[model samples]
Target: MRPAAAGTTRLLCLAGVVTAVGLLPWLSGRNPALTVLRARSAEQEPTREALDAVRRDLGLGAGPLHLLGDWAGGLLRGDLGTSWVSHTEVGPSVAAGLQVSLGLMGAALAVALLPAAALVAPVLVRGRGSAGAGAAMLAAVPEFLLATVALLVCGVWLGWLPTSGWQGPEHLVLPAVALGVPAGGLLGRLVADALPAVLDERWVELWRGAGVSRARVAWAALRRVVPPLVPQFGMAAVGLTGGAVAVETVFAVPGIGRTALGAAKSQDLPLLQGSVLALLLLGLVAGVAAAFTRRALLGPALRDASLTLPTARPVRTHPAIPLTLFTLLAVTIGWGLLRDPYAVHTTARLAAPSWAHPLGTDGLGRDVLARLGHGAASTVGTATAVCLLSLLVALALGFLPGVAAGAADIANALPPVIVGILVAAAAGPGTGGAALAVALISWPPLAAHAAALVQEVRSSGFLTAQRALGAPRSWILTRHVLPSVAAPVARHALLRLPGIALALASLGFLGLGAQPPAPEWGLLLDESRAYVERAPWAALAPAVALALLAGLAVSGAAYAQGRAAYDQGRRTVASAVRKEAPVGI
Candidate 1:
């Protein structure tokens, strides 16, 4: 197919996907307002009939398609419907959330992009791999985990910030960092990867050879690179929306995420659908704008249909750094396990060391150490499992065109928190609830990554050359595509882990993670809050462990990234020398 035709097709497909996603809440037998009404009705019988009457009054009896069309028409006319859950106009509720979400996202984008730019500067100027790796490590740790730790240190220990709620400027700091740190890390990697390619372009080299200053070359390259990066930035925005949901819920912030969560639990379909649709529109607009911008900036070159850029070289292995970092993290986690951070030692308490009372006694005469140890294990185990499972589902679904299309629409349309709320309400708040929530929320990004990876691999010259050389399709996929795609996929997967962990932990912290007598980290933190005046360490220790684990994970990933950047630098230098040597000879 012609490149222009192919591009047009892709765009149309994406648009369709976005539309479908926007409509998913209604299609899935869950209306934001309806869900809430159902739950509310369980407590009071008249409420259900009244809600049903309200639904009818709102023209819901005319079928969903008609209702959806009316809703869309209303939206186009600047009317967002009424919020059944809040008894406010949907427009105002969404507007309020938008203000907070946008503000937070804007701050986060600045925080994320500035550091990323700084990291990229070194790569562009001198091609230092270490800087690249450091950025990657930063990206790998989840935002929630990092924020949780930051909150503890700043809010609890130092009393510098509020632990929860968005009252003022102080409320923004922790959430912004939670959103920005990983984003910055990811952006840095993108800049590091793209800048070199931009520099290698014939026009760039020609400009450089014409005695252009390094600064001018860098500026010119950035101009070209930045347009293509709009899509990524949009993706980051979407991710922030997802993270914001959990963050808002954890801190009891009055934002879209929390509202959506509340609506979902109450089965309020209207509010849920409206919020989701707004988010979808936001994503779609951003994505389409980016695509158009790229085409406009690149002009007819994108239509040439024959020109292709060079592929990045294989990432060099840095076994030592990752291994060492992993070992240190393991040790710390083990120490947290053994230290009995949750155990309470009392002189006059009935302390006994049995299978049940592993850590002896506590202030209330409870087995402190055993609870801590078990809880830590369960918390970590559940988080790890959810991350892996969610990623796997995403990967599989991402590979299927239909599934990808559905996921793209759903993800773009609904905020992660809304989805989490719906899933959690249906499943009930527990380990299963958290897992379901994570899976639903995490799958969208994972699928998006998988689709992009497949597309990139399919377009590579290596695959084309293999086909020309009569290689079997399966062989080409296995030998060429998989290896080329694995490293980036691994990086993305690792980067996603912390976010998943944080989401689960947040649920636990919110009194929804696990049942009583279970040693869940979030639950522990919640329990410790009661004793904050008497024994602050009980709360402080678990929070610290959560943060340390997340930070170490991020650091390890960054180390690997640094090594990858270093390898890329070596290849670029070698390539440049080889190209120059022939001219010299």
Candidate 2:
């Protein structure tokens, strides 16, 4: 297919994805308002009919496919439906939120893109030490921490920007920058990495040797350099859009992100769904437009009708630490089989670390070591469950023609918090609930990655030969595509671990994950807040553990990614058109 045609096809497929994902939250049978009505009107005869009406209106009573069709058809006809909690039309509120968010996205993206592009020229010219290091360091800073620091200094200390709700465009400056700076730093690092490779391309060397001016050579390289960044930026756009929720909550911006968060907190289905759909549309439209722009810039000479770019060089590093972490986790899980986590030590209440309790004791006198061990078991167990479930489901989705990636993209576009909140609402708070929440949010990228690999391998000469020889679909997948998918899947899974860990931790911290008697890292953090000054070990142990674990996961992921990249480069270029899945929040 032609480049433009393929871009359009992909865009159309993503529209289908939007439809699939937009219906996902409503597929849950929970309706808080209806539950309230039932409890309130238990003595009334009309309650049953009212409950049925509420369920039907929310599409909870129908099959998911039927619900999707009904909702999507209504959306096509401009019927946005009324809020289940407020009874207000969702359309106007969504429109206003959309405008504010788009503006914020524009400003944040500009804040990110401009600095990145500006820094790119110098980084390319000066070599990758100073600017590259700075960008990488900035990229390493977490979004939430960045936002918190920005709010503290800019809002509280300096009193320059308001640390509260949306008042005017002026109110956006600090929050936008807080969000944009890290995003910009991320983009800058990508550009920095690409510039070195682009400059080293044989064509660039030939141009330089042919007496082309440095300025002209740089200009040509920059143009080609930007084409690859478009897709990366597209993926980044979704994460940033999702990430805006954290910033929105921190800064109290009344954008769609805030709306989504509020809806999630209250289990407000209509508002949540509408706000999520708007974010999905934003990402879908932005990604398509970016992809098309990349297509145009690539031109015929560069693109060969498939819109594929030169894949980056193999990235590799050692996996020792991460592997060791896994080994230790196995030990922890095994220990859980023998240890009793709930045995209380009342005499040791708020006790410091001792021979008996090496990790100290909580105010409740629970053995922190045992609790931490149990927490590790639970957290790792939940993470493992999420990973396996996500992969199984994603692989199945990957089998569907074009739809898997589209749906995955749509799923990826929605914020993780929104998805997690809804999934948790449906399942209720517990280990299983958190696993389902994380699994639902995590699968999209895996699905997208798997789909890309499947599509790439489907074009191989041998694969075609097998099909010509009448091999079964299942046989071909099991024998051929399945093996090829392993490296990429492993790479993506490892890379995603840190984020998943943090997300799980965040859930626990918020009291939405494992309840009391659970030593989950986030819950430990929450529980230790009051003891920070006196019994610092209460918080420090878990915090330090989380950081070390995150570091190991990142290292392991880096090594896996590098190995995948190296192996991919050794394959045929036509078979090398696989995409790097974006790390989900």
Candidate 3:
């Protein structure tokens, strides 16, 4: 874990990720030439001669290894090759998309930071308890829903801002806010959770007693709290890019995410690969920036010592708020399930809410309420399966941290939506494919948690004593290590359930998940999009449900996190008390 080794590992991981994308054409279960031909000329007949010509032109029959080598070689020469569909060079297209994405991401980061900064002083002065609920509420709202609502209100109803396109700064406002607010909520929560621990450090009291200003003390504490969160911030940036698929599609912003989605849909491997590389490089840049920021914040101590920087720990928080939200969600789902989701009423299409159709009707006259209820099983059920499967995989990989951990490290950086694109290309789009795509990348966080906890448990004094007593390693591992790691990691996985659902929904919205006639939340939103401006309720029902679910999950997780932190605090205080106590006593 030296900095150099870590950096080297990351570079290798990035290479692995890019290499995987290069293999998409081979893995896609389709003929590259035919697929490209169809993408390029849908009206043309797929004769033998035309297929052979495409194969020769694209060197499709050369085998994957040779193709990959050529692509890599061209990459080194600053060539991104040509798009199969557009027949244009991929470089300029990717560059144009990247420019838009980078600007959007930068604006999002600023939006995230400003609100998070505003909360730090309040967290230092007040306790961390109240902030967690609010932060969870804010963070739980998905970008797609936010974009939809923003478009409806700002663009359609009020005409306050341009909703679609990358025309001007004015066009950026809605998308930026949609992407930024959730991130801000997360960042704010982390600072809030970490600040109380910093405030308890002896230096805070010393600084205050020395007549230091409150603002200065808060600033110092914030600086300490933030460095540990650099990784999370970097992940947030990656998440923003992943989320842009839906957000960009909703607003018609021509970002890399949108381009990648289009390429995936058309089976345009070269363009898809190039777009993914751009995103991967953006993630790399974010990581580098974070490392530099951390180094700057920690200064000499960061280099001089092997500091085990404190990360934000889960603490015990009040469960009432989350429990209430969960209840409301359950009730909504139950009510919707009682109605029939598929009963089409031509005259009632886009109808407003009424006694008969409680949540109103969609463009097809399907009951909005019923769709939400039925879609719950599809969306939430898949998400639950994904979470459980992911936890199992994480436990397995987490316990074996050699090559597996390194692979997990690589997989961690691949965005869920990008993974969805790859999965859709290989397996073809469906609910199963979407779940598989999400599960593919969801395990890394839990695995890392388990791996670190395993290391910590194995090194504990009690474990050392057990070893000296001639206990078998297997016995110790099963009795001590497994239990210790499993519970906390399971809780961590539960906390991530909502996020898994959101990822699945994003995929569905992009046509990579559930198809039409399925009441999946993402599909419902997708189905409602055409009429969203006219019949906002069609979209709002599912959007509202998703928001509620996110709020419940985040709030519940925050409570568990807060509770853990509280326990840790108590333990620290007791440890200190024991050290100061008289030996005889």
Clashes of each: 28, 1, 10
TM-score of 1: 0.68
Off by over 4 Å in 1: 1-86, 155-178, 196-206, 249-253, 265-269, 299-321, 324-376, 379-418, 440-503, 506-518, 522-542, 548-585
Q: Model 2, 94-118: lDDT tens per residue?
A: 8887787778878888778766766
Each model's lDDT: 0.63, 0.68, 0.82
Candidate 2: deviation at residue 375, Å?
Answer: 3.8
Best by lDDT: 3
Kindly provide the TM-score of model 3 when superposed on the true structure, using C-alpha atoms.
Answer: 0.90
TM-score of each: 0.68, 0.71, 0.90
Q: How would you order the candidates by TM-score, starting with the best?
A: 3, 2, 1
How accurate locally is residue 582 in candidate 3, as Cα lDDT from 0 to 100?
100
Candidate 3 lDDT over 1-585, as tens digits, reads 444554566568767667777777767776777888887788999999999999788777778898788888999999999988779999999999999988987788788887776656577777444355667678778888888888888889999999788878999988888888888887787778777767777898899899999878878877777787777777777778777777888899899989988888888888988998887777667767777877777788675545443565464457888889888888888998898988999999899999988889998788999999989877888899999998898888776666455666567667788888888877778999999999988988888888888889988999999999999999998999999999999989988988888889888989999988899998898888898878888888888888888777777877877777788889999999999999998
TM-score of 2: 0.71
Per-residue lDDT tens digits for candidate 1, residues 408-499, read 55455444444455555445457877666666656666666776887888988877888898999888877876666555665677766655
Model 3 ranges off by over 4 Å: 1-12, 31-35, 124-130, 307-317, 401-405, 460-471, 563-585
Error of 1 at 495 (Å): 9.0
Error at 182, model 2, angstroms:
3.7
